[model samples]
Structure formats: structure tokens, C-alpha cells
Target: MKRRQTNTNFFDLTNLSGDIRGGAISFLVAVPLCLGIALASGAPLFAGIIAGLVGGLVVGLFSRSALSISGPEAGLIVVTLSAIETLGSFPAFLLATCIAGLMQIGLGFARAGMVSNFFPSSVIKGMLAGIGIILIIKQLPHLVGYDADAAEGLALFQPGGFNIIEQLRMSLGQFSGVAMLIALSSLAVFYLWGRLLFQQRAFVKNVPAALIVVLLGIFINELVRMVFPQLALRGNHLVQLPVPGSPQEFLQLFTMPDFSQWNNPLVYTSAVAIALVASLEALLSVEATDELDPLKRKTPANHELKAQGIGNIVSGLIGGIPLTSVIVRSSVSINAGARTRLAALVHGTLLLICVVTLPTLLNKIPWASLAAILLVTGYKLARIEVFKGVFAEGPAKFIPFAVTIIAILLTDLLTGIGIGMITGIVFILREHYQNTHRVRTEHANNITRIHVSLGDHVSFLSKAKLLKLLKNIPDNAVVEIDGTGSSYIDSDVIKAIENFGVAACQRNIQLVFLPARPAESPVYTLTELADNYRRNNSERGFRHDSQPHLHRQVNPTPI
Candidate 1:
């Protein structure tokens, strides 16, 4: 059986060539995005490269996730920016990152990675939608050939009170015609391929649309420069990789963490925040990637956390940005037919080549093209159909989804998620309390019949509702408490029912149990039964039976 199970391992390396091809394809997707993300993060550009390298080479080696490509992610750009600003130096931020890595390792060993399970799916969808909207807003100016505003402040309002609408208005008069042409043409190609080949034809769909767009943008720019010299775009309009002249120059690029910053409280707080966001993003991405995998292999969340922790530790020490399992690159890897971790290894290796041997070639790629690609990515995340789907599920689902989206848009990712989580938890507790038991009042043969049907499990949290129901029962009525469906009852709840039953007779109401067993209130608490079960839970295996204070006529088991 173990051998049989081993044969199904997603990273079995049986399809090495395909994994290699997939990795190369995914590398094409990762390059421009890595540079763009690092630039947006205010980190030295090479930090993104180091992160991608460590994520692929180190995390891929340790993670069981077959096709999840780990690297510098878009979601953490805000956190990275804020931490660096707070710490006052990149070296101090690096110290915080290293501590974050250690925290992740501790979380994995502690099995706290299961925290993702507590999140509602609606809230998750909302968060992604919020991110998508932000992406589109930030990329729009870049798409139309304007880079006047800082990427972060480009959305709602600039420091000078110019909002996105005002920028769009200004762009109409001063935008780069050549850049706009490239972006429009790239979008046309992207849309054409998406409409014609995406998921429809196996081989054609595997050919990444983003790569084609990048190639097309470069070719168009080159052609324009040759013929229409007046229309040519230059400088920051294209990628700008720091080209090292020699091996020695490359070695000088690395920055080490300042361990002396350990005395700062803000350093520890930043570390905790990074560990939380990074771990959460990694876990969510792993779950989503598994669902996308054709083989449907589930990565152990805790194991993934440990791998990510080790990777971040290595990445931070080596002057890299914080890393996580990124969905964009992983989706490309999957769509390209990745069958193992080798795909990620290949992408990392290829990125290293781009950094070392091909800076000149990489620098020629247009930023407008990259912005166009990210714009489409954003659209996929924040489609109108997502809202429609959530609305169809009713308000119980849509409220959390909408709230999460709005919160994220108004604030940072962590704060938004915290707000959504608190709201979700509140709704969940409300529903649990509301449905803890069913009390139906009926009229039968001139008598008021109140049938109280208990749910499978009842805890102390149900006390108030249970007490209110007993108090509201009409005078001279038939009251029956049924516990047949319940497997376990909290001691406080059991006491409530017994005390209510005794008082029930005083109101000229006949109260009785529906063939239910009784127990000594103190002995039957979940605390006591839990200890009993931990000692031995099996039926006919318990060394003893619990003693109930009730008389033999009502010698009912706790159930």
C-alpha cells in the first residue's frame, strides 16, 4: 500500500523533460514581474532575484507541492515597503525578515498552519478581488505610458490631490503614443489568444500569452526605432536590470542583515507581521494551486510552512526580499504542464542566467507590456461575475465577501483581513447560537405542544437561549425535551434543562424527557467526558461507566 501510494507522488520525476520545459516557460512569466515587484517594493532589484532563486532552489527542494512556484510575491509589496520605512534601513528590515523566517519555522513545528481553515471562502474571494482592483488601478497609468506618480499612491489620490480620474484626464493630453500603441496591441494579442486558445486547445494554450506579448512589444519597439525614430520610447520606459561588469562586481551586490537591531521593539513587531502575512499567503496559494493541479495533490500546509521558513531564512541572510508561494507564477507553471518541483528549479536556474548573462536582452523589454499583462491578471481576480456568484449565495455569504473587499481597498492587506476575520467569526457564532436547538410550538387536540429537539452537540454557549425558551413556554402546556439526536451535551446545558423541568411543573406545565438518559450534572461535563475519552474512547473498551445521580427509572446514558 505504501509503495502504491508512493507511485502517485506528484513530484516523482518521471516526466523530467516536461517539467524542464514548464519551468522555462514559467521563468519567462517570472522575470518582468520580479523586476516590477522589486521596483514597487523599493527593494534593491537584485533582492527579488535572490528571493526567486532561494524560493525555487531551496523551497522547491523542501516543499512537497509539485507545481507551486515560490518567489517574491505581489501581495507582500505593501508590507515590505512599510517595514523598510519603519526600520529606517534595508539592513534592519533584513534582520526582521530573518526573524520572520524563524517564526514561520516555529509555526510549522507547532502545527499552526491549520489557521487557514478558519477563514470563510467568501472572505478569501473578496480579498483576492480587492487585490485585483488595486492592481488594475495601479497599472492603468503604466499601461497608458505614464509613470509620474509613485505606484502606491497612484490609485485614489496623489499627494497633490490629483486622483486617478485626474491623471487619466491629464494622460489624454500628454501620454506616450508609442507606449499606448504597444499596450493596446499587446492587450489585443492577449485577448485574441485568450478568446481563441486559452483552455480550448491543449498545445496552443500551454504557450504563455504573456511571453508572446513581451516578445511582440520588444519587436514593435525595435521596428519603430528603426523606421519611425521620432516615436521611440526610452529609459525607464523599459526594464532596467543592474548590469554587473564582472563576477567581483556581482559579489559586491549582496547586503547582510544588521543583527544589532534586535534591541528594537519595532523590529520584533515587523517580524511577527511578515511571518503572519507570508505564512497565510503561502498556505492560501498552496491550497489554490492544488485545486488547479490536474493531479489534485494536497500539499501539507505545515510542511510548506517549514520549507518557506527555511527559504526565507536563507533569502534574508543573502540579502533577498521576503518570499512566498506566488499564485501567478505557479498558475503559469501548471498551465505549461509542470509535473514536478523541477519546473520551479528550472525557472530559478533560468532567472539566475538572466541575471548573470542576459541583462542587456532583458533590459530591452517594455514596461507598458508588463503593465498590460498585470492589468489582465487583475481583471481575472476582480471580475463582475465573482460578485454575481457571491450575491447568488445570499447575504450571509455576500456580506463577508463585500466587507472583506471594501476593507482591503480602504486599508492595508493585514488590517483588511483582520476586519473580515472578526466579522466572519461573529456571523459564524451568531448562526451557531441561533441553530443550537429547534423549538417548535404546535397546537394538537386542544393542547399547546412545545417540542424541543436538540442538535447533535450542545455546549455552554447555548445556555441563554435554552433558558429563554423555558421561560416563554405557555402555562398548562405539554413540554417535551428530546435528546435522541444529541451525542454529547455540555454540563451547563444539562443543568439548565433539569432545573427548567423542575420549575416547569410549577407553572401547571407537564414536562418530560423523550426516552432520554440522565446524568449527574457535574460528572457529565465535556471536561470530564473529554478526560474519560482521552483515557479510553472506544466502545466496550472503557474500563468504567459514569455514575449519574438520577434514579434507576431514568438511568439514561449521557447521550
Candidate 2:
């Protein structure tokens, strides 16, 4: 029998070693991801690296989740790009990043993390699927070696006039044969290695297929370039590292925001937009990471908010893009067998080393390989299995999921998520209304007895149902409303019930409230009646203290 250790603390040496191994794998994964996200975000390539490092080191140190990896995210590309444009410069955007971080910290302190619970599962899942599709479509051009001078960090598809199919068609005509071959080959090798060989080999099981694909792609690209000098792919298509002449030159790359922009209202407006979008993305990523954790550990959402705030602050200070709990890196960490937060810490250290010492080797890496990796990531995220599962859940779930997917494909991420969320909320409200005002009439001893059962939650949206149920009640009928089981009885439902009570009184109908308490005045509106009942119940230890054994009693009210 294994003895249980008293200490559940995070610093065990065994755990640390696992974290180190996981971190190394995460580092390898993050390098390409950081560069890709940065390139996608329209920021300098180095800025993405800085965000990844800070996310790993700072956020990793402060975060409560042992397995979460943080960095620049593709989801935040729109916000970052807009911030840069609105703020007029990268430095001005840095200021907004700092302010957004501060706002997140404040939200944490306010304990607003529980707000995520309000988001429906269907909507969140739909958003993830949408992002996955976006990732695949956006990276397609780079995979085919047609480097269009388009905005880097925008969504894969554009709304209104611009569309993904049109962009894809344009990109296909300008494809590079060499780059395409390298990308397709890298993808094939990755799939074969992960599928056929990984299951049989212990040593290679933990090795990232992405790293192997990258190495193979680089080698193939180099060989092709040597043999065909006339069809040379320019260095611009490859990853470029800023070659610093000296320590001073390297220091020059670190730029601070000009606070003079603070006076501009547009800057503040952009900051607000950045803060909202970044917060939403961070919350969503945190939720996704929690779900992906193998240990089933729940991350303290508020703590995560504070950690992200700290990461953004540090990232901004050093001229890095704003950071978040990125799904790609977090997923990589889990897939790599990270056991603790130390893995995240180690990943940051590896990033620092790569940027500082391996700039030349890093620059040699091809865009096609990274695109292949992202393509695989996209496939994993928007798997057909998810669609099948949604369909199995019934039309209610499928509608929101399909709507979100289409909305994202047609418009943008935020718009798509918004539509899905709205649809989900509407569904919930409809269900609530249906459940709350169910009226069943029983005919006994020449009198009609009506039983009304309110739902678990009764809000203003349920008023229509309540009114309709009350209007159909037989004249002089005995009515009994059961609110004892209700957890939430809203004011609207209360008002409607009160009006029904008055009508019942005029018709000589007797109205009885179930789980009745002594000294409770029956002459009150629905809202007042519920409030009065609640007060009486609290004093008498009714309804909430224990389940009362329900028994039907004879009543003398006439119908």
C-alpha cells in the first residue's frame, strides 16, 4: 500500500524534474508559436519572443495552475493590431498593454473571475472551433510560400466585402512549389511519425513531431536553395533575427511608451478596447487550459487574472506584446507531460537562451514547417469529432455551435462568439420560462384545483408564461403555487403572481402557497409574496433548512 504524503506542496524534486522535461518540450513548441503569433499580430518578431519569455517566467511564477503555459495568442491578434494602429505606434500600444494589465489586476482583486461561469459551454466550444479554423486558413499562405504584404495579425477571414475563399484563391496563384513541397512533406512526416511510430517507441513518445518537422523542412529548404540558385527564395520568407552589434545595440531594441499619448482620448478608447478583448481572451484561455489539464486541477481564475496582469506589465515594460494564457502553448505543455509550474518556468529560460545564443539557427527555420505545425493544431482544435458530438447533443446545442462557426467564418471572432452567446442565453431563457409557469389543474369533488410549479430560476423573462398560465385558470378555482423548491424567484414573476392573487381574491378563489409558514400575509404581489415567504422561511427554518415531506390536504375552495 502506498502511504499518502502529508505535503501537497508544489516543490518536490520528482515533480521538478518532470516540469524541467515538460518545459524543454514546451520551449521547443513555444519558439515557433511565439514567432508565428507575433508575425500574425503584425508586431516585430522579437516582441512575440519577449511575450513568451515573460509569460513563462513572470506569469508562470505567479500563476496557480501547475500546467498552464502563457504567451502571445493568435486570439489577441486583432486587439494588438488595432491597438498599434489606434495608438499610432508600438510604444503607445505598450502603454495600453500596461493599463490593460492593471485593469485585469483590479478585476482579480474584485473577484470577477467567476464571471466566466456565465458563458455557456456551447458558445465557448464554438469559439474554440472558430479559432481553429481561423488558424488553418490564416497560415495557408505562409505554408505555400506566398508572402502577401497583408496585415499580419488580422483574423483568417474578413467580414462584409472581404472573404477567406477570395484571399485563398489569390494566394494559390502565387504559390512557391519548393515551399509547398517542404510544407506538405513536413506535415506528412509529422502525421506518420506521430501515428505509426510513436506508439511503439518509448524514447520518441515525448518528442514533439513539430520540432522534427521543422528540422527536416529547414534541411530540405537549404538543399533546394543550393540546387536552384536561379529560383532563390529570398531571406525575407524565412525567420529573421535582429543582429545586435553590441549589448548597447541590443538594449536599443527595448522601447518604452511615450506617455504624451495619454492625453489623447483615442488612446484611452483603444486601451479600453484592448482591455476588454484581452480580458475575454484570457478568461476563455484559462477555462480551456483548465479543461485540458490531465490532473483535472482547477486553476484559481482570479489568481490567473493577477498573473496575466503581471505578465502584461513585464511584457510592456520590455517592449513585448501583451500576454495571455495561450491555448496553443498550454496545450503543448499538457501534451508534453508537464507536471508542475516549473515546466512553464523552464520553457521561459529556454526561450531566453534561444533568443540570446541561437539566433542564426533560429533564423534558418522555414515558415512552411511552422505553418504545418499550426495546420495540425487547427485540425486538432476543430476536429470533426467535435461536430459529430455537437450534433448528437440535439438541435439546441447544434444550432449555437453551427451559428458560431458560420458567424466566425463570415465576420470575426468576437462577432461570432457574441452571436453564439446570445443564442445560448435565449435558449436558457426559453427553457426557464417553460419550466417556471407550468399549470396543472385537477378536478375533484366538484372543485378545480390548480397546481403551479415554478422553476429553479424565475426571472422577468418568465413573466409571459406566468401571465398566460394565470389567465387560463378557472374562475373560483383553488390555486397552489410551489416556490419552496425554487432557488431564484425574480421580481417579474413575483409581480405577475401578485396580480393573479388579486384576481383570485375578486373571484372568491383561494390561493395557497406551498410549504406555508405561520404569520405570512397572503395579500401581497408575487414579488412581495416571495419576499415575505422567504423572510418567514428564514425565521421558521423552512424550505432551505431541510426537505419538507409534502402531503396533499383537502381544501374547501369552490371552482
> Model-by-model lDDT, in order?
0.76, 0.72
Who wins the TM-score comparison?
2
Q: What is the lDDT of residue 427 in candidate 1?
A: 79
Report the lDDT of model 2 for residue 174.
75
Q: What count of clashes does model 1 give?
A: 1
Worst 10 residues of 2 by lDDT: 1-10
Please provide, for model 2 over 100-183, each residue's C-alpha lDDT reduced to its tens digit, 9 standing for 90 to 100.
788889889998888777777788778778777876787788787865522333254564333567767877887788788888
TM-score of each: 0.81, 0.83
How much is the lDDT of residue 111 in candidate 1? Answer: 98
Model 1 lDDT tens row, 387-505? 99999998878888888878877666656777887888777877778878876666767888676777767778788888888888888887766665676688889677656655655
Looking at candidate 1, the ten consecutive residues that score lowest on lDDT are 540-549
Candidate 2: regions farther than 4 A off = 1-45, 75-92, 149-154, 159-163, 196-198, 231-233, 259-270, 505-508, 515-559
Misplaced by over 4 Å in model 1 are: 1-26, 36-42, 78-89, 148-163, 166-170, 195-206, 259-270, 291-296, 332-340, 440-446, 514-559
